[model samples]
Target: MTAVTKRFGQFTAVDNLSLDVPEGQIIGFLGPNGAGKSTSLRMGLGIMEPDSGSVELFGRAPNVQSLRRVGFLPEERGLYKKMTARDTISHFARLKGLSASDARARADELLEATELGEFSRSRISKLSKGMAQKVQILSTLAHRPDFLILDEPFSGLDPVNQQALENLIRAEHDRGATILFSTHVMEHAERLCDRIVMMARGRKVLDGTLKEAFASLGQGARISVEHGFDLAAALSPKGFEAIRTADVGHGETWRIELPPGREAQDALRAALEAGAPITGFAPEEARLRDVFVSLVGEADAAALEASLAEDGVA
Candidate 1:
């Protein structure tokens, strides 16, 4: 998509958003709810027309031939209630242009791969919510498309099922399928994505490799010293800004904010040379949540945390 925009009445859901998904890469589309991720994805797949700009799939407008090479799992999931799991997968695969025999074989393969083999003959209404969702996901990929687009694929799954889906995504990538998945949860993106694109309030906020995102925040560390010791005051003279964060059992923990181009070791060296009785020390690592907070401020980050809490993903 290039500068694609979409609107719902007075609300502009996606605004001048341009995104590129390179082949053979697993890209994570990350943002809290109402961040325009779903709208952008819909536009990309030509499910909804953009108000401005343009969208191209497989180098042209989405059509029958191009769409057949792509697999999409929408945020809203549904399966045929009376159909067996195996039949459901086979049905979708056949729609994607697979022969009847090949579709049934693919269904069996996917059922066993996801450990849903025993449930393959069971009706969708007889399966649990998670199992049904998994069946829908498998249906999307049963035809082995060259590209996969998944919107909030992990939203309704438990931890174990989430892990299984992650592994399934990796396997698809290993099979040479390009994948792009959207999620509000940071941990999944942190573990699985090669690059991340973040959105907030219908605008793209950040887009880059994980290392580049971390480097944008510079460096910092956590330091602990003897109780009642003023580490902040002691480190101030050496050009390091330290804030008292918490009091441990026998010490006070301080967060040292290093200036740009400074290293964490410099802070440790300065503290040791200043005769501070240190008890614990650890370099602060940048998290995706921290990056989001830095980009959109605390309020939006808190909203994201609330979304995660509602979904039971800490």
Candidate 2:
């Protein structure tokens, strides 16, 4: 995107943010609730217009053909309450240019894939949220579009269904479909995403591999030695932010956040020098959750409001 901007009057939903999702890759469009994820997606899908900036969906203009070639599961879970899962999915597939027969066939295939085969004839209104969510996923993939966009796909599923959806996503990525999905569950993203794009107030905040994003955050590498671990004088001399100093039943841990340009080797030496039995020394590379919180957590504060004012200029 180049200078992408949008507003609901004075309330800017999206800012001049830029992003990229290459073919055959799954980009984790990640953010918290009301962080402009839905708004940006609506713009990307041409469901809404940007007040200023460009959005190119698949090298072509965002139009009917572009939308048809892309399958999307919106965040809002609204199904035809009276319609059976089978009819609902097939109907959407047919609308997306599938032949009636093809749509019916795909409905069965995805229903079974998502473990909703037994509920195919069940009306959406009669199914539980998890069941309805499965149907929504089936609808999104039934058309076999060139690209897939899933908005909070794991909202109302049990562990089993969540795994089913994840496997299906990996399968689609292996099949070479451009995939972009928004999610807040960090562990799933750590395992699934090739790259992650974090957003706040509709603007792209962080974009890179999970490791890269972590490295770019407040700390470099985190080191947690064994129980009774104390390098206070050793570590304090080197400027490590001691997050805590206590034994939490399970194990005595000292959560330390290293500063930028500062390597963990310094801490390693201190631990060794202090005779703190080295149990674990690894890149506590800030997790996706940590990086996200570090970058976007303060968006609700006055500091963020001022930052947004400067960033909103496009």
Candidate 3:
């Protein structure tokens, strides 16, 4: 996006946002409910145009040639209500400029890859949500496009199916597709993305690798001590911050957020030096979710919701 902005009268759907997507990497575009993620992608897909700024897919304009090289799976579940799973996928491939035979072959292969082999001939309307989701996924990738964009691809799937979806995304990444997707799930971003663009309020709050984005997270490895009360004083002598001391029926747990850059090993030694008996002392760092919440305060969530409910039809 180059100063991309989409507006509906006075409401701005995407506001002067720009982003860079590197080749052969999965970039997680993460945000809260209404953070312009879908709007930006829709503009890029050419289904909707940005009021200003431009979208480039595979270094070309948003025309048939560029679009044919790109695959998009929207957050919404979309498929022909009455088409068979096989035909639904094959039709999309045909639209992408594939010959009928080639389209059918690719659709079959993708359906099998998604474990929907037995349901290949079944009508999409008769399939369960999970199964239908699989067919929708196949439709997007049937052309074997060089770029893949997925919006909330994992939403509404069971753990097993989620893992299956993840594996498929990774396989495409390995085959050299530039995978870009918007997700509310932080763990998926942490695990699958090489880089992340975290947006809040129509602007990026964070954009970088997980390591670079989180380096600012205060140093303190959450460490647990065998004995609660006695450990605080002991650890403090060696300069360990024992922030939380809570009893969970079985034993007392202490959370230590260490000072910035404090080595976990050094902290453990210090705890031991203070004569703190340690049954377990593991350092816990701030997860991606923690960072996201910290970036988008609770107050912004309401406004974000309103932004998403705005019409994108124009």
Name the top TM-score candidate.
1
The pairs that clash in candidate 3 are 219-258, 220-257, 220-258, 222-284
Model 3 stretches astray by more than 4 angstroms: 224-255, 259-266, 269-279, 301-314
* Global lDDT of model 2: 0.78
Across 105-216, the per-residue lDDT of candidate 3 in tens digits comes to 9888888877788998999889998889878888998898899999878777767888898999999998889999897767788889999988876677888888766765
What TM-score would every model get versus the actual structure? 0.87, 0.79, 0.83
Ten contiguous residues minimizing lDDT sum, candidate 3: 305-314
Stretches of model 1 off by over 4 angstroms after superposition: 224-254, 259-279
- The true-structure Cα RMSD of candidate 2 reads 6.4
Clash count per candidate: 0, 0, 4
- Total clashes, candidate 2? 0
Candidate 1 Cα deviation (angstroms), residue 217: 3.1
Candidate 3 lDDT score at position 46? 81
- Write the residue-wise lDDT of candidate 1 on 1-314 in tens digits: 99988989999999999999999999999999989999999899888999999999989998889999999999999899999999999999999999999999999999998999999999999999999999999999999999999999999998899999999999999999999999999888899989999998899999998877776675699999999889988999999999999999999999999886677889999999989899999998778988888889777888888888888877
RMSD of 1: 3.0
Q: Write the per-residue lDDT of candidate 2 for residues 1-314, one digit (tens) a residue.
A: 55789899889888897878888888898776666888888888888888999999988669987889899999888899999999999999999999999999989888887678899999999999878888888888788888999988876666787788899999988877888998766566888998999887777888898767867877644455565556554577667766545564544556667676666676677667767655556655456767776775565333434432442311
User: Each prediction's Cα lDDT score?
Assistant: 0.92, 0.78, 0.79
